[model samples]
Target: MTFVTSEPYIGHMGLGGIGDSKGLLESELRKRHIKWVDNARVTSVDQDKVNVEQLDEKGRVANTHELPFAYSMLIPPFAGVDAVQGIEGLVNPGGFILIDKHQRNPKWPNILAAGVCVAIPPSRPPRCLPAHRRPD
Candidate 1:
């Protein structure tokens, strides 16, 4: 489980606690003779076994190993949008949804974007010399 804290003061404590909890859980599992693999990245999986690449503490690929598990949870990295060919008047040239100054679509004034992936205009003009020189 991942615990995320945005508060400046609690951020450090929350991350430290997560690390400590994971270590304690692993230690307890080891005591019960349960085998555990750390830094094993899944490359692929077949019907019986999964191909994994082991990484060193520095995150460099050191060796490859295959392991069998009754069940596994696989999480994939987030991929960006592909070519927006069929869509018309919805996406910008960069494949991102475009919005106006009030975060409303220019073509569809009723549509408003308010989420993590929503695109917003830069608060200031781009390429302005010395970041502080830009108007707020």
Candidate 2:
């Protein structure tokens, strides 16, 4: 089996990784003989093949790979529904529902949410540098 991900490294899982997940997942994949490609961008997907561009440290295309598959699943970034947009305290700027300790909406006591629909703050700051340079 082959695994492709946009994450900078295996096991990042888009949340800066959980403790030891990087090592553990890498070990498991290796033991199972699963081939993986990280830092990848899916340029296109056809019926039988997926075209991917692997990026480098400077965000340049390092290599392009065409992976053929009989079946595939793509998990994109999560987002809230349009119906929940602009609901003030009930939702975050991205529209994901805001939940408290009980997974209940702060604005509406009767409402609750779960799954990807719930807003989760980043566990760590982003790794990217700022977009603009500071003045001397």
lDDT (Cα, tens digit) per residue for candidate 2, span 37-94: 9988899999999999998866899999999999998888566878989999999988
Error of 1 at 81 (Å): 15
Q: What is candidate 1's CA lDDT for residue 77?
A: 35
Scored by CA lDDT, what does every candidate get?
A: 0.53, 0.84
Badly placed stretches (over 4 Å) of model 1 are 1-19, 75-136
Candidate 2 lands at a TM-score of 0.66
Q: lDDT for model 1, on a 0 to 1 scale? A: 0.53
| Candidate 1 local lDDT, 1-44, one digit each (tens) | 22111212121221223435656765676577665555456788
Cα error of candidate 2 at position 128, Å: 3.8
Q: Model 2, poorest ten-residue lDDT window? A: 127-136
